[model samples]
Target: MSAAAEDEREEQYAFPMPPAGGWTADDLDRIPGLPPHTELIDGGLFFMSPQTDFHMATLRLLEFALVSAAPEDLYVVREMTTKLAKRDRPEPDLMVVPRKARTSREQTWYDPSDIILAVEIISDDSVERDREIKPRKYAGARIPHFWRVEKSNGLPVVYVYELDPATHTYAITGIHHDRLKLAVPFPLDIDLTEI
Candidate 1:
């Protein structure tokens, strides 16, 4: 392929950037079909690469594990946006919220207070955000739990964090590579290797 053609293709897959001053969460809604794999972060638009097969499998596994352990009144959802502020609406890979709670008449976003857990499956496209920006934001919003799932040497590594009310930050509670056992948000266990 020609160099120019290759460059163009690279640009096509790159994340779209908003004009100066950035874009708000509302601006993202103006697009038709509400295109997937995009998010508004700190008032800016970021496009994410699609998950790999293994990543999707791990996500499904964790979702099932969380759902099976949560109480009947709680809901386990994937890719639902949480309105942290006027400019911030992040859709976690998985989230746990109250079953009866509705964030809006349209049921598009959830109120931050309603979220009990937020999970992000790390990918090459989202390393920084998943490791730093998101946890900081989730903590700032006072979300109770934040879990980061990362692939290290081809295996999924789960890091669990719980919010520290006094500091408004997440403290690492557990890190698991094989079996994941946790008591918070109710007891949960999973064989990570199977996924």
Candidate 2:
């Protein structure tokens, strides 16, 4: 058949939910009606948050800026599954993983060892979950850095966490107003206002 038709098969993992409870990675593979892509997080299932016009526009601009500003080798992805060992697996809103990292080709799930920075862009319904639960999980995974973004009120708050040298654990180190500045994991000169 055609290459596009073959490509479609690899991406489909549509499964219906049972009454309640968590799903194993195997269950994820069995989903029969899943949309284009998805990520499993915190023992719960979520379709990637629907993108609003502003959010989509903002993300596209930011994606282009980050790629141009970083090393030619850097990669950016949205709603990527990151394996947090057997206890949990999370797909944050945006993740800057190594160049050419492949989800489908993986021998094992994406682990803390593979990530540089993990990010969460808060939607109106998810502030508490992003600030409290998810960051703790990222810290536990010992992922070197975590970023949290808030894009609601005219200005969005962005926080960055770097592995703290003393504790050898992730700690909040910088706060960049997403509006005032598209702070970090970015080329230093690209201005948010330009987007």
User: 1-195 in candidate 2: lDDT tens per residue?
Assistant: 899887787556435655356665445556667664455565666666566655565566556655666666667766556777553666676677777565575433455776777878776656677788778878777777787766645444567788775676667776765433434555444344443
Worst 10 residues of 1 by lDDT: 26-35
Q: Could you give the C-alpha RMSD of every candidate to the true structure, in order shown? A: 3.3, 8.1
Instruction: Write candidate 1's Cα lDDT for 84-120 as tens digits.
Output: 8777888899999998885455677778898999999
RMSD of 2: 8.1
Question: Scored by CA lDDT, what does every candidate get?
Answer: 0.86, 0.64
What local lDDT score does residue 128 receive in model 1, on the 0 to 100 scale?
93
Alpha-carbon shift of residue 115 in model 1 (angstroms): 0.4
What total of clashing residue pairs does each candidate reach? 0, 6
Q: After superposition, how far is residue 58 of candidate 1 from its true place, in Å?
A: 0.5
Error of 1 at 60 (Å): 0.7
